[model samples]
Target chain A: MLKRLAEVLRGMGHRIIDRIWRLGSGARFFLYTLIYSGESFRRIHLTIREIYFTGVMSLLIILVSAFFVGMVLALQGYNTLQKYGSSEAIGVLVALSLVRELGPVVTALLFAGRAGTAITAEIGLMKTTEQLSAMEMMAVSPIARVVAPRFWAGVVSMPLLAALFSMVGVLGGYLVAVPVIGVDNGAFWSQMQANVDFQADIVNGVIKSVVFGVACTMIALFEGFDAPPTAEGVSRATTRTVVNSSLAVLGLDFILTSFMIVT
Target chain B: MERTTMDLWVGIFAVAGAAALFGLALKVGNLTSSSVGDTYTVTAAFENIGGLKPRAPVKSAGVVVGRVDNIQFDSKTFEAKVTLKVDKRYPFPKDTFANIYTAGLLGEQYVGLEAGGDEQPLKDGDKISHTQDAVVLEKMISQFLYNKASESDDSKKAE
Candidate 1:
């Protein structure tokens, strides 16, 4: 029994050490990935291709989701503000909520599900099939040639995606509030214009999305690069990318909003 | 997708996104609307300002013509002094009545100018002497309750 206890303690200690080592390696990988991004400038076409895959492919879902969110916001806000005879402020409610919160968040979540998963699966496949090894044999840095362009692409595309989401959302809100809900056309717009500040709502939203883009892209690349060379590993990596990206987006949003609003 | 097609789509996406963003900034955010064109400044004083802030819209007959630039308190007169910046296109008469008006029942307060028929157009650095204070709902409710209580007490004594 004493010998068994010693073995179990030793196993636990080994597990802890392994976990710490993995974490340190992961940090090193992250630093190397960022450092190699400087080499991505000359390879703008590669970045564009990745942007097409990640951003363009994710656009439909983002637009649809944002539209519904805005519609719902306008509908619900109109109902609540109606009682107070201030239904005109529905524009304010919908626009502010979408620009500040829903636009970046929903876009990021959908991006994770669609583009992020694809990125992990593709990279994991490349690694699994020895494509990465082949590149390494040729003295081509995979981090610079493959990962950096994709990372920079994601970062570049995210703000544009978020902006499109918000603009489309505002349109959706307009449609529901102005025509369907019978909100005063002039009042709705005027109240919204009077209330929402460009610096406070729009700029802050862009900043939030930029931060989320970096975080989500980093998580995707990490999961892909860290996955073992197997089909099952790639599948698991894709799942992890989606899950981790979602959590990161939501968590980063909360922190960013706290800072943005307080300041 | 073909590389050229993808590139074209991306260019469109980026440009459209930028245009939409600019529109949002201009329309909803009201960035381009303020501090553009020509504007002149005038000052008004009131007994109570009531949650009014700088950058609040200054409306005339439901049309936004200017914005509140600043607010200061006068010690001797015991009044709130408000600086109004009016667009040059919208020149108000000398006898314009500036009143602090709330948009809705429980909405943001702004300065609503009731244009008076004076031949002379008000210029920069002019003082709007005729001003009205903001309505304090809490104070008004308390006064109303006090009035009702006193009325009930007087009626009881009479009986």
Candidate 2:
């Protein structure tokens, strides 16, 4: 019995040490990626190409989702506010909720599902196919030439996509509130304009999107780079990118929101 | 996509995004500074300031003319003292009534300036002698309940 207990204790200790080693190496990989990112600026064309893939391609999903989200917000908001005899405040409700919270959050989640998965899958495939090794053999750091552009692309795409989502959402709210619901258009818009502050709502949202962009992209690149050179590994990495990014976005949202409200 | 075509599309995307952001700021967020000119500060005193915070809108005739700059309680008077930042251009008369008003019935409290028919324009550091405090809903309810209880006691005695 003592022998068995000692064996179990040794296994647990080894597992803990292994986990720490993996975490340290992961941190090292992130720093290396950051150090080599300057090469991406020199290769501006590549970054732009990545942007087209990440931002422009993802625009459709972002737009559609935002529109639906906006309509729902207006519908739900009208139902609640109308009971208070203040249906006119629905515009404020829709705009504030979208611009301040939902727009950045939903856009990041969609970007993760769309562009983030593509990034992880593409990178993991490259690693699996020995393309990353081939580049290294040619004296090129794959982190600079490959990973950095994709990283920058995602970071740039997030805020732009979020902004577009908010603008489109406000439009959707208008469509439903004014035409379908037969609410006064002037009141819907004017109340929103009067209440929401540019610095407080819009700028802070942009900040949030940018932070989420960086975080999501980092997780995607890290998971992709670390995946094993196998089909199952690449698929797992893609799944991890989506799952991890969504959780990260939600977690960061709570922390950032508390800070934003205070400041 | 070709390099030039890619650049063009990216450019368009960026421009459109920026334009939308600008429009959001202007239309929905009121990002642009109010058309009001340089502003000056004034102060007001209230008995109770319910749910009023700094940067809350200060309005006149239903138009936002300024913002609440600061709020402090006077140790001597034990009343909430609020400082107002009013636009220099929209000068109010000396007799302008500075009153705490609630928006949307149960919404936030703001200072509403009702311009009194006085030709004399108020200046910086001047206090409007006329002021009204916020009406606390809880206090009103409690008072009503007290009155009802007293009336019931009076009826019991009569019986």
Candidate 3:
């Protein structure tokens, strides 16, 4: 019986390896399709819709959350700084923390949870329903039609959304510091302005957001395309997409920070 | 196909608009107040640097004139020694005083300098004679509250 169990386990391992190899090959095919395509107009349209949905549509929530985050940072920073009587540096601390780290990362994770899950589930459902197969049968490349649009959308939307998040967060910090925490508005903005450098923090944030967007879209599309042909499979794919995308965003953030240090 | 063409144009416009806005915001932020470019080096001796870090701004008269470049311990003095980059244009007189000041109620600490004297200018690598260490706010507040409560207790006993 033990010998039989060992044999089964070995078989399962072989199957898993074979499955991973197949998935890798499929990914390569998708990459080739993207590279060979000349459908610039189609890609642009897809990207625009993605920006509208992922950025414009999600603006309200991102702004609200950023505002609160900024305010809390300022309040907390102010409380601590008041001890040594250098309360004016609150702006610099808030701006640096938000622009350099928190703003882009938090916004990307939020986007992954919302748009990333939706795209995965939508694609998975279409696959299970035979819509994707029907498109292929009709000589339409699903790679260009489905995957390209979502990929471009994520790439286009991420930077815009991240910028908005940072702005709102700064404003939030300003409100908290000036009114609630009793720091002067001029002092707050002045300190922030004095410390923040556009090249180092802002540009770095935008670059990070773009990379995050690409990772999120790719993970979602991959999970959706590989879903099992069942109702349960679509649900599982959606769950996996969100989990994977969130983890990927965090992982990429660390890698990007390390890379930024070197560059 | 026609819709795709229009969308393409729209995407271009949107990207351009976002980029323009971001540029404008950055310009405005820079215009209102900007970092000091002049750099001078000053050293301070501290019993404890605490969590002080590099890239921390060094300010004079509530305006940043430089940054903390490095921190190390002096074996002979048994104190943490900090190296500062002050703007070269902002002349530090011979008797300038440096103190570690915290921002807001819970913010990061920075080195604050008070310019002193009408005599000789401080040269590069000159040590600031006086240094006030970081005063942690929470500890002070708690102490103040404790003292207030004890005073109230004394008054109640006398009554």
User: Which residue pairs show backbone clashes in model 1?
Assistant: none
Candidate 2 chain B, poorest ten consecutive residues by summed lDDT: B28-37
Over A49-135, each residue of candidate 1 has an lDDT whose tens digit, in order, gives 888888877878888988898898899988998998888889999999989999889888888888888889889999999999999
Q: Is the docking of candidate 3 incorrect, acceptable, medium or high quality?
A: incorrect
Lowest lDDT sum, 10 consecutive residues, model 1 chain A, at A35-44
Q: Rank the candidates by TM-score, best first.
A: 1, 2, 3
What is the TM-score of model 1 when looking only at chain B? 0.84
Candidate 1 displacement at residue B94 in angstroms: 2.4
A175-243 per-residue lDDT for model 2 (tens digits):
999999988887788678768988889999999999999988888888899999999999999999999
Candidate 2 regions off by >4 Å? Answer: A1-19, A182-186, A261-263, B33-35, B38-41, B60-66, B85-91, B146-159
Better of 2 and 3 by lDDT: 2
> lDDT tens string, model 2, B87-134?
887999989899999887866678999999998989999987789888
Stretches off by above 4 angstroms in model 1 are A1-20, B74-78, B156-159
Candidate 3 Cα outliers beyond 4 Å, as residue runs:
A1-19, A22-26, A40-43, B1-159
lDDT of 3 by residue, A107-202 (tens): 888887878888888889889999999999998877777777777777777777777778778878888888877888777776676467667777
DockQ (Cα-based) for each candidate? 0.74, 0.56, 0.11
